[model samples]
Target: NKQIIDATIDYTVAYKPNIAFYETQGSKGWDSLQKTIEYIPKECFTIADAKRGDIGNTSAMYARAFFENMSFDSITVAPYMGRDSVKPFLQFEGKWVILLAYTSNSGSNDFQKLKIDNTPLYEQVIATSSQWAGDDKLMYVVGATHPEEMANIRSLVPNNFLLVPGVGAQGGSLKEVSAAALTKDVGLLVNSSRGIIYASNDIDFAKEASQKAKEIQQEMMGYLDLLC
Candidate 1:
């Protein structure tokens, strides 16, 4: 992990460590997570990727655990429980709540794509959640696999950043996603997890990972240039 960080931090602006990977290992894993979080450069944004959201009290504890305990800049949250489940996370100043709206996995269609009064549930999640906080404190997860939905989502929350996964290994097109979602601010954080990190398993893994990340960044820059 340290080697990857050293090699790619130059091209990476954020690092999201999915908590499940660490917690499944118990205390030793937690220690490693803490060290990784601390090791990340202050200039880079860090996301817990915990996807936590529950009742008010439980939510508050989750918020404290990530925001205070871990010192992550933000955490992904499941907003299906409604405002109370998400509000606690918003209370912490300087922290961000990245609400799950449209996910890349097939199961997302079962709920997020369902219509609530003719509006897709994912759209409702964005429109309704926008009321909870401004773009500064809130962002949305819109999967790259669903690039067609990006324009609709941007219309709902034009100013909010979108954390897009499913690019690389998930067969999502970075070009399509950037075209649909990029605002003048370039308000998108496209994630490429296994594709880059697991690019190689041998001695040259870090170098290979760096090359993969560089290719993505260069493509992203081309899109950014178009916005100018």
Candidate 2:
């Protein structure tokens, strides 16, 4: 992990460590997670991909654990429990709540795409959640796999950033996602986890990971140029 960070920090803007991966290892894993978060450059965003959301008090503790304890810039949260479950996370200034809307996995279709009064549930999540906080304090997880829905999502929350995962290994196209969701502020945090991290497993892994990240960065540069 240290090697990867040293190699890719120049090219990467944010690092998201899915908490479940660390939790499985217990105390040692948590220690590593803390070190990794501290090691990342302060200018770069850190996302605790814990996907936590519960009742009010529980949610407050989760928020404190990530925002105060770990000092992460943001944390992904499951918003299915409604406003109270999400509101606690927002109370901390300079911290963000990344609400899960449309996930990249296939199972997302089972519930996120279901319609309520003819509006897709994911869309409803975006529309309603947008009212809860300004774009500065809120973001939505709209999978790169759903480019078409992404366009609609942008319309619903035109100013909010979208943490888009699934490009690369999951067969999502960077161009399609950027075209559909890029805002004037370039409000898209495109995540390529396995594609970059596991680019190689041998001695040259860090070098290989750096190259993979650079390729994605270059493509993103092109999109930003087009946006101009």
Candidate 3:
């Protein structure tokens, strides 16, 4: 874990620690996560990828736990409970709430793509949740695996950033996602957690990870030009 952090901190613009991974290990995992967050450079944005959403009051505490106590710049939220479940997170100034809209996993199709009033459930989630916060404070999770729908997703929330996973290890094409989703703000945060961090297992793991990050950064530069 330390090797992964040391290898990619320089090139990574942000780091997301999915809380479940730590929860499984009990106190030791929590300790490691705290150290990992501390070890990360202050300049990079941090996200607690805890897909949390509950009743209004409960949601508020979850927001505080990550944004205030843990000091994550943003967090991923499940919008299953509607506006109240998400509103508490928006209450914090300068912190972002990345709502899960369309995920990369296969099971995402089971619900997200279902149509309600002739529109996909995920579309409804995006359209409705966007009303709670502006682009600066709200973003959506759209998997890179669904690149074909990116243009449609972008059209719905033209100004908000999209936190895209599934790149690299998940076989998502950065080019396809960028071509379909880039906005004037270059509004996308494509993540490649396992792919880059676990690039190798030998003594050269860090070296390999660094090279992988460099490769992604170089690829990103080309797409970033679209923003110019």
TM-score of model number 3: 0.96
Per model, how many backbone clashes are there?
A: 0, 0, 0
> Tens digit of lDDT per residue, candidate 3, span 199-227?
89788989999999989988987888867
Put down candidate 2 lDDT per residue, 140-160, tens digits, no spaces: 998999998888888888888
lDDT of each structure? Answer: 0.93, 0.93, 0.91
C-alpha RMSD of candidate 3: 1.2
RMSD in angstroms, all models? 0.7, 0.7, 1.2
Candidate scoring better on TM-score of 2 and 3: 2
lDDT of 2: 0.93
Query: Given candidate 3, what's the lDDT at residue 197?
Result: 76
Per-residue C-alpha lDDT of model 1 across residues 39-142, encoded as one tens digit per residue: 99999999999999999999999999999999999999999899999999999999999999999987889988999789899988888899999999999999
